[model samples]
Target chain A: MSNNTAIKIENLSKMYRLGQIGTGSLGQDLNRFYAKLRGKEDPYSIIGQTNDRTSEAESDFVWALKGINFEVKQGEVLGVIGKNGAGKSTLLKLISQITAPTTGAIKAKGRIASLLEVGTGMHPEMTARENIFLNGAILGMTKKEIKAKFDEIIDFAGCQMYIETPIKRFSSGMRVRLGFAVAAFLEPEILIVDEVLAVGDAEFQKKAIGKMKEVSNGGERTVLFVSHNMGSIKTLCNRAIVLEHGKLVYDGTAEDGVSYYLNNQNNASEKNLLQRTDRIGNGKLKFTGIKMLNKKNKSVNEIIAGDPVKFNIDYKTNCDIDVNKLLFGITFWDQHENKILGYSTDEMGITFSNLKNEGYFTLNIPCFGLRGGTYNIKLIATVGGTKMENMLDNIENAYSMTVLPGDFWQTGKANRSGNMALLKGSISQHNE
Target chain B: MNKDEDWDIILKPKRNLLDINLKQIYQYRDLLFLFVKRDIITTYKQTILGPIWFFVQPILTMVIYVFIFGKVAKISTDDIPQPLFYISGIIMWNYFSSCFSLTANTFTGNAGIFGKVFFPRLIVPLSQITSNLIKFCIQFILFLIVFFYYLNSNAITPSYLIVLLPVLILIIAVLGLGLGLIFSSLTTKYKDLKFLMQFGIQLLMYATPVIYPLSTIPAQYQFWFKLNPLTHVIETFKTAFLGSGQFSLTGLLYSCIFTTFTLIIGVIIFNKTEQNFMDTV
Candidate 1:
């Protein structure tokens, strides 16, 4: 290991047993023990399957993390991007020493602090001042050091008046504020944060992201951030990796890793909607395929801010049900997961009485009034007419489109970027 | 890369079961102090009696023991006044039991914090031992008040072995800590062990010479009673305090050996369990 390498992990793997914990697990543990005593390979290693949390694991043991190899340089902010159950958290847990890996070693140059979850050791019955000490202790800081940083942490968290009060009385946002404040001030040589920023409100998230940026840039500290949110990853991380099924499949710059992750969504659409794993619905009826269509009805991956477009939602109802109470809708979100537009069949006051068990619905837009950005579409289906009782289906990020500026008004151009909605109006001035 | 000879720390899987890593404990001494404060302060928070409950518990237990053992059960305290003798035994036993039960819940109770952060996990068990000592001291004041009253009345004579009070307390502590460590590790995977421990610990009080002197035991049951290591510590404690009851170096040595071996085994098992208890717990 060179001096510039802040952290080095080699062949790290963790296997977790299934079914009743600690009962049958003791047998497996003993097996490994006797195997090691005989200088043989790990006995359970052959039966371990890759971690795929969304599916029913095929074996009695699953490798939560397997064959992970990586090296982080000094002052590097590495983003870890993965879908649910992709072993991102497992990697962080191993490196943080929250648990031991079944195999391999991790060597680092300096202290490592992990904010795996905010307010990790914070006691609800203890005062915030005291919890600061507790949290600091868990983060491997001395009481003297916490005392020195006391005022700064409080001022940063903006909970000075309630510092003496028990943390149970504080709102969740305040708890996260104080939690992040303590973590940011530690200034450890390596910081590992795992999806904790999502707990805070928007303003606190921004502040936390900025603080993380400072931690990586100012003190020559390496950081590993695991988040499903690609936008923040792009904003703060210089390099990134993509993990899928307990394997490091892609390693590159942050921009490339994000693109690689987002591009995987294309394969889901190719597999058809009913087969997609990342969805929840009653399955009474389902969307077969959804695509963005241009004015000429040609499917396009990218659309413009202005000009006409339509969403062709092809549906095939499997079982017989009342078609009149059914409603179709789509919600669009900008790059930052902010809702930009929501359109529904109810808004148009149209209920088709002649709908069949197998057909398609085309949502036509006279003018696509969205500013320049990448927007994702969520498909929704509801039943029970105006009562809207049953939510038959709701798929998030089902289809994504990149919108650019186009000629809308007589000014010959539309907006360039960063606006949620576009409006159309003409101001008529007379004797001004 | 060549085992990283230049690195500061290398984290690997446990190679030995007895890697207690006392240096790590020494490095995190401040955490131990903070946890001690947390336990002591939080124990009384939001309660009406607050710190007074600390004194009331042993006093009330002593009163009940006096009524049952001294009056009704007709157990002899070796001619020592009933209240003073019962109070001393109750405080000592209370300290040991408290240490055991508190540390027994260490892994399961702190699983939330343990899952999220990494520190010297032993700090939790050690802090339990220390915090229970604080409660022991508070109740010791009650034992002292009764001791002084009986001393003025010429009921008993204080032995020179009274100076060995710290040693007796240390043995009791180590015994409690050892048993607690063993139970905590077991209860992580065998959650039913916690409930069993509660019932088992309560029954164990009768086995030790707490309310009655070992001399009260019949000749047939003396060997079995001596088999309980706490019997020695408690008998020696009474002999050291009131200048009565049996006192022998061999018995004390047996207790010491039992305590040391139990503690070593407890620590080894505890260190092993802590590494991955988050998974099973």
Candidate 2:
């Protein structure tokens, strides 16, 4: 580990046991111990599959990560991107030494601090001033070092008024401010942050992003950032890696890596939305097919703002049932799992109370107004009743859509702000 | 020791079964202090009685024991005043029990912090030991006050072996910490061990001669009770502080060896379990 290489991982893999303490718990461990004495391969390790959240698990063993190999150089910022359960967090966990890998090794130099989540180790009962020292020490800072930066941390967190008050009395926003302040100011040789910007309000997110950029560009220590926000990744990271199903799919410059991950990854899984076992609903009705199309009815991965995008939901009913109150709805959620907008058949006063068979429903937005980012589509099919079995189908994260930047205003300028949604507005020129 | 920066710490497919990395623990000493401070501070916050609760627990338990065991059960204290003898026993027994249970819950209780960050992991149990030590020190002062009163009244005599006060305390602390670490590590894999821990410590107190003198257990059963490592520590504590109980030099030596062995085995099992206990816990 020279000064040039900050972290080096080779053949790193993590296997997780499914269920709790019944089968393949201690018995398999003893068996593995006996086999190792005879110089044989681990009997339990041979049956693990890659970490995929969808699909039925075959055995009690699953590989949360496998065959992972990467090297991060000193003073370089690396971004890790992957779909949910693609082993992004697991990889960071291994690198941070929170949990040891099952079958490989990770070697790194200097002190490493990981901010896996906001307010990670902050004690709720301690005062803000005291918690600063505790969180700093947790990240490997000495008492004298934290004292030197005490004023700076207090000023940065902007909790000067309540320094002596316990943090449980502070609002959640104030707590995040203090937590992020301590984490960013610890000044370790290596920093690992996972979705930290997802916390706090919009203004705080902007400030946190700016601080992250300055920290990554300091040219003194390395940084590893993991987030679902493509914009931040492109702006802050110099290099990036895309992981799919616990395997490294792409590794390159930040721009190309994000582009490849967004464009090509998860295409097959997205196409087979209904086959995924992650959904819950009655077996009477289920989603059969779903697709997104451009104005020309051509299938596309993304659509520009102000364009007419079409969503078609194909359905199949198992038996003839209540058609008078049947409902087909689609909800849009941003990458952060925040619900953006929703549209439903019942809410629109459209009655599907007629006889139905295998058919499809089309929902067309006049302009398809949504911000330029990937959004998750949740399919909600139900009957109008409060009964326990009224739900026909509720498949969350069934499909995804990507909206691109467009000049909706026709002013020869695009929307440069990071607003959550786009709108088509009419303006009348008038002097007040 | 190899100083090549190529691998400051190499994590392999399988860890050495008994590698208690003392250097790593030393490196994270700052974290240990911080955790100890957190444990001490956060425990008393928001309560009206505050830290008074720490003193109240053992003092109140001693008063009840004096009333029930000394007055009701007619147990022998070897002719010494009842409260003085019972208070000393309660103080020592309380420290060991609190330290044992607190450190034993290390893996299960702090799984949130342990899952998100990585340090030496030993810092948690070490902090538990130190924080409980602070509590024990405060309670010990109370015991000293009672002892001074009994001495002025000529109710008891002090032994020359009172010089071994620190040794007796050290052995009990180590025994508690060691047993706590072992239970904590094992419970992560088999949660049923936790239930046993809850009741076992209570039963173990009776077996250790905390409420009664060892001489009262009858000569036939004396050797059986002496087999408990804690029996020697508490017996020695009473004999040294008040000069009223048996003080066998060989029993103390046996306890010294047993405490060392438990601590060593405890640390090895703890270090091994901390690596992957998160997956199971």
RMSD of each: 8.1, 8.4
**Steric collisions counted per model:** 0, 3
Q: Model 2 segments beyond 4 Å from truth? A: A1-3, A22-24, A268-370, A373-400, A404-432, B1-4
TM-score of chain B of each: 0.96, 0.96
Model 1 preserves the real interface contacts to a fraction of 0.81
Query: With candidate 2 superimposed using the best TM-score fit, by how many Å does residue B232's alpha carbon deviate from the native?
Result: 1.0
B43-120 per-residue lDDT for model 2 (tens digits): 988899998988898778888988999999989888988889888998899889988998899999999988888888
Model 1: residue A427 alpha-carbon error in angstroms: 20
Give the CAPRI rating of model 1: medium
- Give the lowest summed-lDDT range of ten residues in model 1 chain B: B1-10
